[model samples]
Target: GAGVSQSPSNKVTEKGKDVELRCDPISGHTALYWYRQSLGQGLEFLIYFQGNSAPDKSGLPSDRFSAERTGGSVSTLTIQRTQQEDSAVYLCASSLAMVTDTQYFGPGTRLTVL
Candidate 1:
């Protein structure tokens, strides 16, 4: 199967606007994750989904950030009321399971909030 795919590879928006980033994980992958990376920084975990269990969203920076996965395959990350500090790349990754598996990442969605 194909690797994860994300839509709107690049986005530029004004402060306080909303943006939706979509991701399509590889088939049969039960674990999915969302991460954010700022300039010259490491990947910051945002949210994670595994199988039918409750998603671990502890990494979300604020209440305005949220994500959901459908059928354990496609996922979407939504950022409400974007801010300048939110300018960074949003990455999506997936694996067969949560532990002892390699996560394959997609080409990140570069978001620039002005």
Candidate 2:
């Protein structure tokens, strides 16, 4: 079975640019999450999507951050205007629909804005 995956394991972009990070969750998993971890900082929840319910955007840092899940599977996170403060490791994880269930994470897309 294919595990979760993310693209551009590392990305370097200039401030104010837009970057699209991709995530592929594990097969059959219906719950997906997007999180950001600043350098030497803890994980910060960004968004969460489950099958059919409205997506939870409360955790999103700002209006520039947005994500969407398609067909209850793959998801993409778009940072409309990348900022220096946005430089961090963007991690995506998937779980088996149990809040207490441990989530499986991807290698992560490290974004570095200059």
Candidate 3:
């Protein structure tokens, strides 16, 4: 089956602009996650969605960042008022379950906010 995939492989936008990054997780997988890797920094957890349960958004960096998983499948991460610091590789991953499960990662969407 297909693995996790993110859209727009690369995005360039002016500061303060809004950008929407998409992710599609593998079928039958009930766990999805979003992460960001900034230059010279470790991967940062952004959010997680499991089945129909409430999403864990504690990892979101700021109110400017938000996401939603629909039909327990596709997900969209929306960043409002993008900032220069937001430039990074946004990664998506999926697993059969959480925590102990093995996660499959996407190629990631590279976002550049100028």
Give me the overall lDDT of model 3.
0.96
> Which segments of model 1 are wrong by more than 4 Å?
none
Candidate 1 or 2, higher lDDT? 1
Give all TM-scores, in the order shown.
0.97, 0.96, 0.97
Clashing pairs in 3: none
lDDT of 1 by residue, 1-114 (tens): 578999899999999999999999999999999999999999999999999999999999999999988877899999999999999999999999988899999999999999
Report residue 54 deviation for candidate 1 (angstroms).
0.7
Give lDDT tens digits, candidate 2, residues 1-114: 478999979999999999999999989888999999998999999999987789999999899999988888889999988889999999999998849878999999999999
Where is the poorest 10-residue window by lDDT in model 2?
93-102
Clashing pairs in 1: none
lDDT of 2: 0.92
Ordering by TM-score: 3, 1, 2
C-alpha RMSD between model 1 and the true structure? 0.8
Q: What is the lDDT of residue 63 in candidate 2?
A: 96
